[model samples]
Target: MSWQIWFVYGLVALAVLLFFSGRVRLDLTAALVIIALAVSGILTPAEAVSGFGNPLVMLIAGLFIVSEGLARTGVASAVGVKIAALGGRSERRLILLLMPVVAVLSAVMSSTGVVALFVPVVLTLAREAGLPPARLLMPLAIAALIGGMLTLIGTPPNLVVNRALIDAGRDGFAFFDFTLIGGCILLLAIGFLLTLGMRLLPQRTSAPSDDRHRRLHEFAEHYGIGDQLRSLRIQAESALVGKTVGEAAMRREHGLTVIALQRGRWLSSLNPVLVNTRLQADDVLIVVGRPETIATQTTDLRLSDQGFPHGLQRRYRESFGAAETLVVPGSPLVGKTLAQANLRARQRINVLAMRRADKPLEIDFQDTQLQSGDLLLVAGSWSDLERLTGPRTDMVLLQMPAELADRTWHANQAPWAVLITLLMLFAMATQVTSNLVAVMLAAFFMVVTRCVEMNEAYRSMNWQSLVLIAGMLPLADALAKTGGADQIVNGLSALFAGHGVYVILVGLFLLTSLLSQFISNTATTVLIAPIALNLALGLGYSPQAFMMTVAIAASTAFATPVASPVNILVLAPGQYRFSDFVKVGVPLQMLALAVTVLLVPLVFPLTRT
Candidate 1:
């Protein structure tokens, strides 16, 4: 073998070691591969960086943005909620109902995003049904992985293999080419999970129901402010009609703290009680104080008594929520009083109560000096509360009320998101434009229609995954250029020289599936795809069946927690161990291998056209 081939082999071995160790980020490892290849003069700089401009990378990026649009607009959340309702407290029935819904969504959207959207929903289902989260989360992850096989754009591996075929001077796969085999696998998986897979999962006891996620009333009860809660509406002729919340002096005169303001009729609008929030006629103020003090103050201030209605609680849950934030050591607010810190004016959130030394402070606690390790209960619109989760030096958000997940930011825009997604699908299925064009148009429409904001569209991208794919593409090219791929294919051909093509297909599937468990599936497919193509051509058989098998095998990352991002996502939440995956995942992997080997040849013949 030439020195170039030897060098490529050495670099690939090192890259695989780094991938398995995971000490370096996958994208960084890919970057190192690119740099090594370019510096060794094996590939020119332009050739090394050509993968960045590849249509496959752009298609993946566009799909991410489109998926984010659906998420931000509440389309995915609504689907999850509707489907979860059909389960009706039966663990078996929930698995039957939930897996198909998740699988179908995963076929169009990102599997990781689909899993994230459903995790909380599934947790809620498990809690309501009196089942352990472990019982359901594994099935959810497996369904998502299988869902990726349903469409050409469902996963990166599908695109990688398609690009390889096109580069090999063949036509690429159509949009729904993967659906038939993928649907069959999904059905088999659902059946397995409903029966044996459920028994294979661990039954770790879930956190107590009360401890899972407390409601608004539960939070008020914990803080001892439930009895103090009151609501009052402003009279038209009242003196405070035009005064701001700070100027109203409700706290100083009546010993009542204004928590929020409801401006529209029927409590249609709710906002955090910021200092600049101006009071107006018919505006309702949700306040906390003793009944005697509140009654006397209302009579004097010309405010009409409006008892706290149950509807207001529903509105509060929908538009506003509370969160617990801890003042960490070295925080700038550690030594300042709540009034001096001015969180209301700056963050537009009310500090409803504070806790120190594991006990709730007195109601009149704003003047109290803040200290490290102090926990404050703050109230705000859900959007503002979400912002606190970002990078901050003053305080860290410890927990949010569970109802926060039900709050939707752009519920009104949901129809537009759905329409745009459907239109994109129609375009792709009909071949009105190339797959890349269809996806890019959808991404553009998502932003133009305000389904997702411009900034959010950019933030929604998984840059790490994109960089990893782009960087690794050149490595595949280097392998092909230096005859490294041919060398590997030659050995495989010799091993299977006397065997039937079906045996070789099974071997290829097993090898791809095994490598996928320990590395990025896209990278696995990129390295294996060219070899599969070369092997098929060298054997005088068509490459379509082999290429299709490679793509399907790369997605069978079900046997390990570290295998896929979706698996890692559910690991901690489900309280799972490594053994739990092996107990369930190995059988599923074998099932997929059987299905792919049996089905691919039937769908795409082995004869070269």
Candidate 2:
């Protein structure tokens, strides 16, 4: 290899490390890699930029826009809400309903898209059904992973590998070609999840493992604005010592939406409106809604700083307009009452809301408190706020308001939209039309018919993944062109030379599984597809079988957030620790590995050497 290639290799290694470390954003890491490749002359500026416009890359981007359109129309979220209602009372029934639905959607759309849309829904449904979120989110993520493996255009990784194989002069596997083995593996994994997987999850871990999230400390800081959540002694003049939330509401007529009633530390969401539920002194009412609304209705209600939006600008002058603020740990207002913070007056901004890592705010607006990792929704000119968060070492602004695209999805023509989208996917699968053409037409139709607005369509696409794919595709091509693929194939073929083709098949599956955890499925597919073809050539085995193995393995990212974007999304809502994934995921991974290993060799047997 030349010095340039060596340098490229070093950059690639560093990029991979940073990707798994989760320190920097993935999009930035991908951008840096492309920049390094361009500077190192591994790719010309034209070649480096060409990946952005690649048809496959464009297809992925377009699909994201389509997914965004669906989201805007409330179609996807509506589907989730409807599914939750249908699951009925039984947990098994719920799994049966959600798993297959997620799986099928994943097969047609992006897994990340499916997860983003459904993770919240699943969390909400689980809490409503009174089941732990840990029981459902793993299955949801895994099903999405498996569903993508079922078809050619199902997942970005599958598409990347399929296209890479075709680009390398081998005919790509058909859309449904992976379905038999993939379906078997998916069914088996789902069964394990429903039967044994739920038992392994940390049942009701210290955090609210249910999707409702409502953590006590965070809620107290962010939403508990007033004496709605009082921990007070029965003073000589106090009026609520024995009066319940219902009694106070009926008498005081305050617009208090009680999230929960806590008496002597016992919390209950039941009978929130019943005035007869006797309340003792020092009992807390975790309420929701506006502070002024609460105070005007209730008597002697001293406002506290429970929901005094943390992580927003604490001190904003007029110059702090349209900028960003970061929330640092151990700041002056870390645990202080919002009233004490004088957030509205001193900061000259409105504390809109706060999002905590562990739970959703449950208490009424009058009584929440701020906590660490609380993303405070503040309304102010960004330039007016000073940098209390820190320069480089403290809690940083993870996202800015302007950077957040408005995802106000609206589904105007729901039936026609879904029908046309399905037809397009079907055409792509059946070979009646190319995916590139079919999806493009679908997008065009969506625009011309006003099913989705042009700006909304443009805004919906996942530009990050599109850019990453575009950058990596050329590098993947270079790896094949540089004889890097052949080197890898030779090593693999030799290692499994003595063993039967089954061992080689199993090895490929495991290798792809590991690579997928570190890099994206799309990157894994693009890089591994060429090598799999070479391995088949070396062993005089079926190239189709090797390709299928690579395709299947790349889609099964069940182990960690580092494995898939969908996993990262549910991590917070599922209230899952890193270990929670492994505890449940390892078994499913092993099952998928075993099933694919056995089934692929049987279905597409290797020729006798």
Best by TM-score: 1
Q: Give Cα distance to truth, residue 367, candidate 2, Å.
A: 29
Q: Name model 1 segments beyond 4 Å from true.
A: 74-76, 83-96, 105-145, 148-184, 191-221, 225-318, 323-378, 382-415, 449-454, 500-502, 511-587, 596-609
TM-score of each: 0.61, 0.54
lDDT of 1 by residue, 1-609 (tens): 999999988997887677656477767887998899899999999998887998767876787788777767666655544555677678899899888888998887667656755775676567546678899999999999999999998888999999999999987899899999999999999988888887898898555554667766677777767687778899998888999888987776668778888887532366678787889999888887778888898988888888886546545665678888999999999889988998878998878788889888865887788999998888888988889999899999988886774565665677888898787777764567876887889899989989889998898777776776678677777877998866775676578657889899988988888767755788779888988888888889988899999999999999766577677667656867656777798999888988998899999988865
C-alpha displacement of 326 in model 2, angstroms?
Answer: 28
Model 2, 7-83: lDDT tens digits are 65566578667755657765677678777777867678887777778777656555555555554444554454567
Give the CA lDDT, 0 to 100, for residue 67 in model 2: 55
* Model 2 stretches astray by more than 4 angstroms: 1-5, 88-96, 104-141, 148-180, 191-412, 458-462, 500-502, 512-551, 557-588, 600-609
